[model samples]
Target: MDSISSRIQEVTPSLTLAVTNQAKAMLARGEEVYGLAGGEPEVDTPDHIKAAAMLAIQEGKTKYTAAGGIPELRSALSEKFAADNNLEYAANQICVTAGAKMACFNAILAVVEEGDEVIIPTPYWVSYPEMVRIAGGKPVLVETKESNGWKMTAEQFEDAMTPATKMVILNSPGNPTGAIYTEQELRDIGEVALSEDIVILSDEIYEKLVYGENKHVSIASLSKDLYDLTITVNGFSKAYSMTGWRLGYTAAPKPLAEAIEKIQNHSVSNATSFCQYGAVAALKGNQGFISDLRDEYDVKRQFVLSRLKAINNIRVVEPKGAFYFFVYTGQLGLKSMNLTDKLLSRYKVAAVPGIAFGYDEGIRLSYCTTLDVLNEGLTRFEQFCREH
Candidate 1:
């Protein structure tokens, strides 16, 4: 009999990726499937960013870089964090990784220890809990309700903490929920983390895509105490539409940054050198393209939410940020997996089931594609409800 490590056995496969892969295979087989299952932007990487990468390759900057990051990219990220989020980060306080996923995993490895508790609010991205489990920390989940717009309450978070709690991951403009945390709400949690000496891992990768006048507040700005305890996790992926480049960086206390660097040194070693150059260009070049993408996303968000809300059994909150609309489909009485399967087989409108994100009552739809595709997908969804 073959034996795998207990750690490997304990971690489960990513459900969202599994469903997405299945849909991709069908699409490859000539099915006209609308792919709302992918967590990436459908838009191509803008020309200027691509041009920068080409220039980087021409200049021969494509070799190994420092395990942490290139100096220029680190400085740009630090400045970007300070200007955009009002959080100051020195060069030494930054660590660039392959993606925000690696940045997050490295952060967890740096801070979490065996038997430590990492509080993860549900309706979370598929990776958070699995990453914690891999790090030898128990994932203590706090269920964030749909009625509250999925922003967790102070009480819910407080009830989940113990002396062994080392960190709490807060993904605002969250992945599946798209619920933006009000400033006061973030402050409430920030204060608690400060009190408990729990580190706040603020995943603000979607900070730039918010709709309306709802601002994305950085918890580190709440107080100096909270600032010291908070690690601001952000990337070039969502904001600048650079997901494929695999460039992400985290700004934490200098010591924590060092520890993450050590892990990187032993692991993947650095983010791609040319990609780091492209990331620097992304931060410094035209900011207007981001606004252009956000405007389109806002239109899609409204269109999809209004359409879903009109359906009898579906409940969709107009998402305040990001590209997703997390709609409750619980009345279908179909386990989310079955609902998704039926949608794929019969309707060909593929969306991610909420069960993948640790919730079973709903599904996530990405409106990141063309308006025509979104409208067609919504039409299929509307019909699916009626027929079912």
Candidate 2:
């Protein structure tokens, strides 16, 4: 190959995937490794959803359908946004795609252009900045601190916005940090975004994975102006344990939804046909599965927090949502990548380095594994810290 496109060059490999794969390779070699890197839920796809997919297959619903999504699933999603999030959206304003990741990608491509600045918060999901880079938009990262719960402030949001600012990416029940913005926090930031006329790509993929007294609030539900300026991206993966089903959708204003649909149409050409039915089943049939899962996750979250607390010289804010603990390891006197590599190669524990999420001297530990695995990993991590 002579040379790859610069756009492709601008993108970086996902650190979460890299750590997960490295752990898998270690296990393949018959080594004992505790993989605490990935964010995917360990639960199987719910039976009702799987049954719906099977029924669709039996009924010959495997053929190509609408480029955006099946009408039934879109309608179900519209009802879901309204009933659950208090956001009114019609099927015509929804664009379903392969994953919430793709939904975000489509929305970014639809709205962002060259030289446009997209404001993102620090300790963000690894993909947000890379997606902006690939879209030819400059990613303006606003650093939020652990002291402030890793949540962006209205002042920071305003300070980052320039005349060139075109969009802002918001991830709640956020990855790595597990921080969820409160209704007031979102309203404050939403005001700045509204005043600047910046569109918001609100990634709510982890909305249902929240814990404690914490609640997930959609900025779009705060006001009509916020709703018009926000692209709410959600999916069946986190809530329904349908990661492999690859079905996610965005609810936006009609014109933006159409743009997302057009991008989805020319690129992936809709999600898998039968999987859409499974998603429909997920939205319509689910009532109790998520609650039970949340209870279990809450227990696991506490266990992880306790383990991290016992380890000396590690600083971690208690996570209120999602399933991660962003543990600061600056006292260990190692770069984040080196610390992560040592954890995997020497300690037989796998974790993603904080540098991957735009934070230094830290690592992200996901507690979405079995109790036995979590115990072993935390034990090894504590021992490694003591040795250092």
Clashes of each: 0, 0
Estimate, for each residue in 1-388, the C-alpha lDDT of model 1 and write its tens digit.
2498788788889887887798889988998988777778888888888888889999999899999899999899888878888888898789999999998999899899999999999889999999999999999989988889897898889988899999999998899889899999998888788788999998988999998989999998888888888888888888777887898888888778888899999999999999888888888998999999899888888888778888998888778998898888988788888999899889998888888899899899988888888888889989988877
The estimated TM-scores of all candidates read 0.98, 0.98
lDDT of each: 0.88, 0.92
Model 2, global lDDT: 0.92
lDDT of 2 by residue, 37-125 (tens): 98888989989999999999999999888888999998999899988899999998998899999999999999999989999999989
Give the clashing pairs for model 1: none
Q: Judge candidate 1 at residue 385 and give its lDDT.
A: 85
The best candidate by TM-score is: 2
* Model 1 accuracy (lDDT, Cα): 0.88
TM-score of 1: 0.98
Residue pairs in clash, model 2: none
Query: What lDDT is reached at residue 198 by model 1?
Result: 95
lDDT of 2 at 7: 81
